[model samples]
Target: MVFAPGEKPGLEQDEVKLQKASKQIVQTAILRALQQVSQESQQRQAPPKGGPSLQLERGKLTKKHEKK
Candidate 1:
């Protein structure tokens, strides 16, 4: 689109294609993370009043949250 008369239009087409691809990649990463957290919450039960399993599950949740 920026070309003068007689110049090739290939570079302009490449720029537009690159911009769309970049946006698609970023949005896909965000949605995948959201899906993981929701899935984890569904599979887990409430922690025992107090025990090692409770502590370990809580620690795992914290680590997964930190990863994002």
Candidate 2:
């Protein structure tokens, strides 16, 4: 149970390493969650069923905004 005065303890070093590893793991998980949420938000913001699906009356819309 005794380590030389100047020598580092393996158990303590291992615990420090594990702490760093866990922090990295948590950070990566948070990054992934944020990315997924952004993707879902973008998908929801996209036009439904892709492209314009408007069924405006023939004279309802002005020529200024036509999809042509």
- The 10 consecutive residues of candidate 2 with the worst lDDT sum are 55-64
Q: Candidate 1 has which clashing residue pairs, if any?
A: none
RMSD (Cα, Å) for all candidates, in order, is 8.9, 10.6
lDDT tens per residue, model 1, 10-64: 9778889999999999999999989998876754565444333323464463322
Kindly give the number of clashing pairs for every candidate: 0, 0
lDDT of 2: 0.74
lDDT values, one for every candidate: 0.67, 0.74
TM-score of each: 0.51, 0.58
Task: Report the Cα lDDT for candidate 1.
Answer: 0.67
- Which one is best on lDDT? 2
